[model samples]
Target: MPRPYLLFTQHGWADTNQSMMALATALTAKDEAQIMAPCLDYAMTWLRIAPLIDQVETLATATLAQQPELPLRIVGHSMGGLIWLEVLNRHPDWWDRVDFLVLVASPVGGADLGRILDPLKVGLGVAADLGKDRRPLAGRIAAAINTLTIAGDIDGGSDGTITVESTRVPNAQFVYLPGLSHAAMRCHPQVIEHIQDFWAGKRLSEPLIPHPLVNRLRQIPGMTDAHLRDFARSTPWHTFTDGTSIHLWRSPFGIDHVFLASAQGDCLYAGYVGWLHGEDLRRSLDALRGEPELLEKPIL
Candidate 1:
């Protein structure tokens, strides 16, 4: 007989476990999987995330101790996904047992809004923790586990809260639901259907093909991907030979936001860097100036 599934569903910031539990129930209606949905304090979510992580870790460890042979399936929404990433990073031994992992509307790439709230990174409540980028850790975990990232694109780029670009992770299958909001993702029918399909050996979405300009921008340290909705406000900075254009927008806080637009004026990529990475971004762009194929005419 096949081993029973030990399913875990986690809710995000300012959310109760009710929606996640409902989702867990819907997912396991046929398989009778064991579900673990912890009710984290809603008020406490405004604080640091470490304590919340500790609570879930302790519960999961105890449950696993009792059922050592059960296979694992995890579903985390928003901050819940971030918490699971940290937990898995702390326990590599749990990797082999994770049959599947699903992150719904989770910002794996540091949240831009979070950084905007706490621009100085001074641990101002939960902003500092939420602003942290966990892609490297997520990439390592994805390399070892069957991972799926589901994002909501209500505004062509964001889920009304987290940017679609911020939900991306390396080596993971990605699914984006149109007109879905961040809060709606926790129990959205389409989101549930996609998850069910993914588990049944169906490919619901394709992996994004890497773009050369985007790849180079990703290499620059401390860069956080932003939403494309703000691209209209940015001024054109440079235009490349391939019709790719770069735009710049400085935030009121003096942070530099960059946008890469395609030949047809589509926002291909958008990212921002804090004061610390200002020089790095400048030097990287200057280096791109020397590449003839990349730069044809300067619009600055």
Candidate 2:
């Protein structure tokens, strides 16, 4: 059977496939829906120019071409979400194909971090193209699609990396969660519930009951606080790849990106950030032909 919804994760520079796959694992349980998180190529960051949109459209077309019946829904974390928006802006026809767009901690407005660094130096060239006066991809897509931007309030105001205001687009619905870090929103079950409820026809404005574990994770030491700090310090860089690199991030069940990597590894990681069950992480690592260190250490 074809997938009805595509859930994707667009990792910032510091993330990896392992982290996103771990998120996909946590979102699943005994009777949960099936989800796949494909890692995207690094070029998405720099390919922010016009061609990047074409890259995402091609991916959506390919996913649906394999199974034409499946509807498309795009979910991108960080810049990947913006990539999805860029795809839709160029291909308005795909608007009907997309059921929902969930962006996790993405800077729909120009990111403050990007602004802080001179636009010329940011390797992805996104800063260069997405100039102060230039309209953002998020702003462009918000006018065309059913969009939702979710920001984490772990740092009181901002989601560690993106500010609350930056995640806002003109017409799209916006959500702000307290305590959840920018990266942790992926693993937060409440986020999954929000997505599922939206899939079940809930309005974008519907209120959701908070997850119980949301509070407990903060009480535990060395975990929540550590990630919070990491989220703040996390930055993006370039990734070096030869030839045409097709990075298919699995946020929307169908949409993705294709890019040409520069000599420098100047791209973002296609990963997810969330609180995952240790057992699930173990299983996912096994599935990915990798081993997780969490499984080896004794839980004190």
Candidate 3:
């Protein structure tokens, strides 16, 4: 019998190996495949594209060294996606080693949040690394391999931290999860199923899966229902599209309550909407990205 392919799962910035381990574990349950979850150097200080490219190539080379004969498959979340792109670019020969690639909530078009807070040691090459207009590696990534781009949209169309726009690229199959967040895209069962089917050569259907809201607002760590009431009729509201920005001011009590919506008036995400820690909170938000002074934050 032919050997099963090698599946490598890479975690996003400030994320642990376990971030991709859940999906890895699920893929290996039947003992028909093997998944390798590698933890990258997710430091805020080392976000420059060149240095990061070197780091990823090293990891990929070593992994391939172990079982060079097996065909390769990859799943990268957020920064992990970019890392793999660079790996393929730096070592063109590695492309021969890869069979399929999946990018989940990766800012291949550039991270809007990175552009906003680049001063706080978030220097992932903000100059050329954070916008859709300057996707130099798109051609490299779009070549030869069938790349799958999956995103979560809880706010009009965002995964709380990444906009669906930020995660897309030309010549790639895009799957959007209307009810999932950037982080949740990593572990959501629907997301796992998507990866599983795509890896096994199954045809991805049209009108991708839809995730439903589950009163997840009150699930935020430091928020309560009282905080959500701040969005009542008289309250000021703001709106934006994917890869855009929205500023919310604290209501004197040192807290900002936010809600996310689509242009046609549809809700996306709900939770404790606070600043400094991250995006997504007691309110709904869409077209949002990133965290402030937060090494690690949750997506809406």
Best by TM-score: 1
Please give, for residues 109-135, the per-residue lDDT of candidate 1 as tens digits.
888788878878899888889889897
User: TM-score rank, highest first?
Assistant: 1, 3, 2
Query: Poorest 10 consecutive residues of model 2 by lDDT?
Result: 218-227
lDDT of 1: 0.87
In model 1, the clashing pairs are none
Error of 2 at 159 (Å): 1.4
Q: Model 1: C-alpha RMSD to truth?
A: 4.1
Model 3, span 1-300: residue lDDT tens: 335777888876777878698877886566445677876555632455566657667766787888778888888888778777877776778787787889888877556565445424344353335432223465456556777889887766457776565565655667777888788888789988887777667767432222112122223433221212233322334433332223233566555544444344443332232354344442333322323322133323
lDDT of 2 by residue, 190-230 (tens): 77777656556667663322121221221222111112222
User: Scored by Cα lDDT, where does model 2 land?
Assistant: 0.50
Cα TM-score of candidate 1 = 0.87
In terms of lDDT, model 3 sits at 0.59
RMSD of each: 4.1, 20.8, 11.8
Local distance difference test values of all predictions, in order: 0.87, 0.50, 0.59
Best first by lDDT, ranked? 1, 3, 2
lDDT of 3 at 227: 19
